[model samples]
Target: MNPQSADAGDRTTGRYKQKREAILNAAARLFDENGIKGTMLSEVAQQVGLSTNSITYYFKKKEDLVFECLMHTTSTISAIAAESAAGATPEERVTRFVTGRWKKLAEAAEGQYPAMMSFRDVGELDASYTKTIFSAYGDMFRRVRGLLAQGPVTSDNRMSLTIRTHLLLTSTQWTRTWLSNFSVTDYGRLAAYMCDVLINGLLAPGKPWAPTALDEKVAAIKLPEPSNRNFIAAAISLLNEVGYNGASIDRISARLSVTKGSFYHHIPSKDDLFAECVSRTLAVVEGMQAAAIAGEGSGGDKLAALARSLVGFHFSPRGPLLRMTAWTELSNLEQFYGQVQPMRQLTQTVVDFLATGMMDGSVRPTHQAIAAWMVVGAINGSATLDKWVPGSEKTDAVELYLKPFFCGICSE
Candidate 1:
């Protein structure tokens, strides 16, 4: 090849790489804003100021783009985890791993990291691609488990590790919803604060980690039965399993052992059903929060009560709503805004409980707002209880799930 031609080819290659990066960045933001299934290739191209054909020239399909975006995030975080593993102490290693990962994600061009991925359609992908993506996730989990084991936690039980790791990852990944709102200067402090709360918890040293004693009557409070409750429950289960787009009216009706006419008789539409499902979950949470507020020993005590209640709910028949509340599913619902008040109320309930703990010196002095979200994230992750420890007794599940969060692993 001639020297000039080779140089020209190199320039074209560099430009192509830049454009590809831009597309990925735009796709990540769109996926985060409007879910993987909701985003279109044309929107991605528009965001990059390129034609759809030009964008397709780089990523051939949306799944291909999603696969690459997910791979990019997992690989980047895995690399960071590997680097942080070199820290001299377990605490140091965990801090470094958590903060380093967040800092790198924050540094990316807006929405460049595929922060939260929905696995609902993984079955639709080629078998090999599905396996590859899951394998990558397994690698990331293994690295996190290793770091967690090195910490002050005494229990090496598989269940403990699973819960802790899920909580940690969930809390960090949720930043995709809030990270852009934060200034760059706040990233380091926010990351460090989250790590501290996850590692050390809200409990102050010398505070005994006793489970809060709940009055049987208060603890027994239940969600008020709504009209067409059975249909809503059925819809919740379907939505939890298959997500908003995949859950159809016929399927929801089938799950209830009812005809399509029966479903429509009780529920007007799928959107209305989704809204009711979220309303039901929020109602349960609200009842728990109210109980905690009215009948607690301290802020920490109230928080424990709330956490225990949530964990226990996941083992009940209505447990599927716990999964439905996950950001992936919730983001897809047309009635998301309708649930916003309840969601914020639940968060504020946590924040208020944590703040009370801090004031009373029962909880550690830290950022209450962030700590509250971490607590909620941990509770949300508990929806995996059935998958994580199938057939386990509810009492054992609740204890194992809440232990790490309410009571830190470090010994006094």
Candidate 2:
């Protein structure tokens, strides 16, 4: 009741807030690395020098913590999109929005702010929090979509703008995967180059989006198809939906209308199931790559073919390749290291393909490694296409989805 006592209470409250923020920061980084389902409250507490019970004082449960983290990220992004809407034109709005985001990203990477988590794992959160998170996310998405519209929406241009909205946002999110390769100071340049790519596209002027077919080579790849009534087939679909940790043996078995014994009979363990899924996903990815390279076409044509194959496969009945984020759930450092090597090698393969395009003058002369990674991110991030463009799974992937990447977002 005394003035000194009130002053002391203020100091304690400030410290509590600081400590709570510290936990949130640590939890966000862990969620970025290991996903929400894979992160632990104890790990977060350990990062902040607090006991697990102490964390409960701030957040009642893991979902509460995760929901707050996700809401923070969505709100931050929505603010960016809203600020960018001040630009005079759609293209200006896009450039301003993207550059603003990258600057913040650079600041965060250099410890200017707490790290932000991606929405890739938001679908895996507890049911109680999903509705609110989805509402926030939908608001954020509509604001981004606002940047691409200046006139009344029509049936013809609605889908085009919707897909572009997804592509632009997904490409921004994809930066998290490749932004570490450069010095933080270089992010400004990277952001400009990315805007250039999105606005002008990778192809040299006047190039068309014609792609060589990958069907024959894809058929010869001899991997499990998505439409099949098999274990791996059902597992891949389930993994794509709920993420790695959320895709349990029971869920997979029940999806296939089988028993847990049958799951054990076909797959030895959960890790083994994930390993097999990863192996198959890489196979399909590599097979598509090889198919594109082997096709009769220019470098740009091959790149188009590759992008179409990967994106189309995802949105098609043959698709839904294990969402690449699922690969991050392998906690065993040994298995993680061993399994990730091929994927790393595959990324280099994409760089090489981009180099080939540049050499033949089919593609523009830009940063190859960055371009390669962007293409990879574009494909991997398309798993959310259904949410962005309702009924996107049944649409022509090349036209509505991959076109904006191959041709500029501002293309006619």
Candidate 3:
């Protein structure tokens, strides 16, 4: 290499890297603390000891700065996940993933990062911007699936497992939103418990779910009337405020500033309103899944896209009603499970993905059912941890801690 060329290359690699990292770090800290809307360019620049013009030189627009900050925060999370997943056992990996995510949630809660994300609709902001976020999410899920797909799982099963795991992760986030009394640690414990049950159910030697049984069950129950949009709106608003069981038909009607007569005109029972909420929530989830599958990418790529979509869906205010319903519906376990199956579907997807990995000889075959359930259980538990955990303990790092458990189940 020529001396001048080498000198130029060194300069390009050294100072540029440092500056970029500094800018991103500054952005992440400010955005996390003040939120997208609350923080201005001047604020971020002031913290970095740079002029507003200088910060704008690097980020160009306010949205660019916000996106960059989000990217940095999520990238830090991705790096932690990657490090934890490296050279670890399946169980270890699962634990790390779970724990790591919990930590992330803690950061978010302390900094109110989700509040920042809520400031704007991510996808509507920009196509490329959304794609970057989705890519980060999909990458994490694919990594988890790869670890779980070892052993008796075949290629086809791997796909299912991938999806299922995604669902569990998303559900964990969803639960965090309304958790009033539970601590973040309690959510982690819940993740562990659910993982245990899931492992038992999946590794039980045969298929636990029977479509015939499901169909019969569905047929036996009377479906609720969800066609009334006004009733649906009332239910959504009420659930959004007080949560699932707490939201009654009377409360919903009152919120609408209307009479119980109006509520009855549209729906007959509380069960009917709940059914409507579930259906609407399911529709939203389905739309997100479809977008993930349809977006540009292969299976692995799509997996990442799906993860962000699910995360966004779970945390978004629009779906809070359904989340509230999820808690209330637990009283009707059979009906609840029947309705929330979509929520749990990510478990099946992860299992299916593991099966695929087994066929391709890319994943180990140590314990299929065990791995699958652990992923779901931990994910589900983590989703609800944020709601219960208060103060400094609740952040976004919850996802990171669960990775090790995944490692323990992964094949070498």
Per lDDT, the best of the predicted structures is 2
Q: What is the lDDT, from 0 to 100, of the residue 298 in candidate 1? A: 81
Q: Order the candidates by lDDT, highest first — what do you get?
A: 2, 1, 3
Candidate 2 deviation (Cα RMSD): 4.2
Model 2 ranges off by over 4 Å: 1-16, 213-229
Q: For candidate 2, write residues 1-412 as lDDT tens digits.
A: 0111123354478676666667667888898788677889899999988898878777777888888888878888899998998999888998999898998788677666566777767777766788888999888988988888877667877777788888998899888777767898898999988988888788888877765454445334556544233777678777766677778888888998889997787778988777777777778787777777676777787777777777777766666677766666557746667766767776777787779889998899888888888887887768767755787777776687778787787664
> Would you list the clashing residue pairs of candidate 2?
none
Which candidate leads the pack in TM-score? 2
Could you give candidate 1's per-residue lDDT for residues 40-92 as a string of tens digits?
A: 89999999899988776777678888777777777777888898888886577
Give the Å error, residue 195, model 3.
4.6
Per-residue lDDT of model 3, residues 1-412, tens digit only: 1111123454477665565556666665454334444457787788668898876556677777667655554565456557656635545655566566666656555543332122112332466676776676567556656544545557556444544454345434443333444565565665564444333222223211212222222223232334565667557655544445557667787878788887788788887677777777666555545554344433323332333334333444333334422443234556656776786666566565456545544344544544554444444443333332222123222223232233222322
Per-model TM-score versus the true fold = 0.84, 0.90, 0.40
Candidate 3: 10-residue stretch with minimal lDDT:
206-215
